[model samples]
Target: MGKRNITDEEIGLIKAMLKRGMRNDEAHFHFNRQDRLISPGRIAQIKSGKYGGDVAIANDTALDQFLAESQQRSGAPAKAARLSGPDWGETFEADGGGGFRVRGGETDTVECKLSFRMNPNRFAEVVKSIAGMANNKGGMIPFRGT
Candidate 1:
């Protein structure tokens, strides 16, 4: 065979995988294991809408169910809030992996603290951030750098 094109069914699975946060290389490996040859770059192009294919829509019901089930199995929340606005709290410095860097920033949705004190006022502010997030459709607080 000279070449084989991806079918609608494969496109659906690929779309589902992408939506589930699977990287292009990961998806390529997944399909290759099943004897379906696909390049990571091609997958990326498909995901980015650069190529034309019958990919599943974002609101696919089956994709949603797959994501929810995967999250449950992984013991993670189905949804998470992103940190918005500016960074707060003290300056933070740490390094992980092969690189190290230091930065201190806060966002509207996040309130970082260098340390937790027994001061009632500080505690109240922390609680206020939590309550604010809860009331404002949820957000994230890294909490004393972790």
Candidate 2:
């Protein structure tokens, strides 16, 4: 039979199954039982990072790369599930933390929080910024460390 084109989500589930100590045959059988078309050999290939396809992932870095490529292919704006302070393309210096010191500072999407919440207004501003980010194409809200 022809190879089934699996979604990234399915690939993630397979990865999870592998992490849970399930063998390739077990994962294949599990999926097949759920009516999903995946083979034990294919599952092994995916885990070995030899799956010659777009959804290839070997580790965290590879997964990040795969997700970025997938997002780019879909022509959809990147969604932020965590704080990725800055992009590699951006001109900035790392402060040895999950933050950046941009040369020119905040852009249309990048926002900075310089201090802790001292009052209701400041807390409200932070909340609004988070909501704005979630509602938009998603972005990083870097908070300065004291």
Candidate 3:
């Protein structure tokens, strides 16, 4: 199939995922389904009030509390911090495949993942799915054998 385009419907879904306090991995799944790119770093940017819309939500207090109090501790995801840079469109990875990231130079960027693997052909479908997500959120996939 041809590459999918981002829609208001999909962006709305992303907003829904945001309101639910989804962490990086979960958000990644949702973004894949919605055909929008997002990483733990982007998610964090949204939460921290930097990327996307200019008008900040009124419930900053709630967000602050959530970040400060969530007990589901997690390792810090890698970030490239290039969202506004010339190379902001790429996501990088390491040699070994423990963790991979989209974009960079920002904290908590694309965190959630589809978290599955398949044969080469099947993996293409997964890549297509993530490609749409990346189009919407803007990043590269660095996961090995992804």
Candidate that beats the other on TM-score, 1 or 2, i.e. the better one: 1
TM-scores for candidates 1 onward, in order: 0.34, 0.31, 0.28
Can you write out model 1's per-residue Cα lDDT over 1-146, one digit (the tens) per residue? 24446655566767777887876754553354335556667788778766545455545676567556655553433443443345322223454564323232333334555456559866887777788668545556555434
Which sections of candidate 2 miss by over 4 Å?
1-4, 33-36, 52-146
Better of 2 and 3 by lDDT: 2
If ranked by TM-score, best first, what sequence of candidates would result?
1, 2, 3
Ten-residue region with minimum lDDT total, candidate 3: 70-79
What's the TM for model 1?
A: 0.34
Candidates arranged by lDDT, highest first: 2, 1, 3
Please give, for residues 1-146, the per-residue lDDT of candidate 2 as tens digits: 25657666667756866776766754453344335556657788778766644553346565456546654653434432333445533545675687566534443356666565859767788788888667544677665556
lDDT of each: 0.55, 0.59, 0.46
Q: Candidate 1 clashing pairs?
A: 84-108, 85-107, 85-108, 86-106, 86-107, 86-108, 87-105, 87-106, 87-107, 88-106
- lDDT at residue 133 of model 3 (Cα atoms): 57
Q: Model 3, range 1-146, lDDT digits (tens) per residue? A: 24434333443444455776655555444344334554546556555555444443435455444333332223223333544455433444442566545433222334334454678756876677577656555554333343
Winner by TM-score: 1
